[model samples]
Target: MRLIPNMISSLPSSLLRRAAFVVLIFGGLAACQKNDASAGQVTGTLNDAAQAAGQKLDQAASYVGQQVDATKATAQQNLDSASAPSINIDPAALASSAQANLQNAASTANAQLGKAASITGQGLEAAGRKLQAWSAQNATSSASSSASSSGSSSASADSSDAQKQMDK
Candidate 1:
């Protein structure tokens, strides 16, 4: 009879210890999840492209989905004359969002547009970052904005040299 009372008393403490352990485990898991959610984040600036350049880019990009080769000439025109506004980008976030957008697009044509826009935005953003980085390193703002194959490294270097003298 006495032992029964003792066992009952010990039972509550044992249960309490188990409960504390469970709470600790749950809290740890929650914290770990939060940390994971915050990882692989990208930070950057927004793009405010010139109205004309933006419109041309949109048209050319949309056309690309329908006529990849047919837009070649028009794409050149847009790129050649574009004094487009700048759009900054964060590569990590763009990649993740683009991934999600691509998954969503697997169902329909409208989704495909979303996919296209996402892809275009990501590409432009990445290009912008690269251009900005190059300009910063080389002390010049003239990186070829051309989307065509003719944009060569030598041309970029020459342009940078010319821009330096022009800046003076």
Candidate 2:
């Protein structure tokens, strides 16, 4: 008791207040240090979780990128194929070919008619028959122009048949 009294008498009020403040700060620090271990563990767990989440995000991004690339490649291939020449014949070309074949058939049949007039009845009958056949073929081909893709082939057949008759 006497020692306490002597110390209080020796210390100024300002010094006492400063000393109390320092003690309180140290006491709070000591209490916080006691819980530091658990806090450190929680911080480490949070860091690991964040790392795992980052890896998952990276994987998802990579997968999406691969899918996008595949889709682009497929689209490009479709575009290339669409731009390629088709196997189907042009409608205008088929009509032109059919018209030309009909003209040729008519000219040839007229020539045959002129020759048949010089020849016998049998020659005239054959030439008349060839002309009728050519007319029928042309009619059928013209009617079916918008209906089928084989119009060009049919026209070629008609021209060949007319040539065969001419040869005969």
Candidate 3:
């Protein structure tokens, strides 16, 4: 009991406040459970609450660590810049390099576009030939069917005429 108070006093004020808040919340929940819950149920709820609080504290610590690291890096960069020598840049050379890169990209893009167009045209030509062949086949089949139907109708007319002559 004495050690616990000493440890709590050693913690920063902000951390102590946060710890007190977590305790108050879980304590209220435990009090509420004591009214309608078994001892085991209250214990389980406390366990879960403790675990959640621990996870939240861990996350807060990790975030603070990351912020500290970022601040340190920025400070280092500022110090380095203060002591580093100035750099000389040639604008003309930079412009020439940029222009060369742009031209190369444009040439590569044009070549790819040309290849795509050629492939598309070839695909269209093949599709057109297939369509033409299918149309010709359908036309020939329809014409033969029409001729066979006409021949069958003429034979039926001849058979009717022969039946009429026999009745006379």
Per-residue lDDT tens digits of candidate 1, residues 1-168?
A: 133234324433443353345335433432332111112221122222223234533543453334323233333443444434574444455444433433332223244334444554455455446644554544433344331335677667766665664344
* Better model by TM-score: candidate 1 vs candidate 3: 3
For candidate 3, what is the TM-score?
0.38
If scored against the real structure, what TM-score would every candidate get? 0.23, 0.29, 0.38
Using lDDT as the measure, name the better of candidate 1 and candidate 3. Answer: 3
Q: Which stretches of candidate 3 lie over 4 Å from their true place?
A: 1-87, 151-168
**Total clashing residue pairs per candidate?**
2, 0, 0
lDDT of 2 by residue, 1-168 (tens): 123223223333333353345335433433332121234553553344334434433443344344344434544454455467884555455445444443443344334333332333233344345545655565455546633656767766755664454444
Q: By TM-score, how accurate is candidate 1?
A: 0.23
Best by the lDDT measure: 3
Q: Model 3 over residues 54-121: C-alpha lDDT tens digits? A: 55555544444443444345444544554656944454553444344434433443443344334433
Task: State how far residue 61 of model 1 sits from its true place (Å).
Answer: 11
For model 3, what is the C-alpha lDDT against the true structure? 0.46
User: How many clashes in candidate 1?
Assistant: 2
Model 2 alpha-carbon drift over 4 Å, by segment: 1-37, 87-168
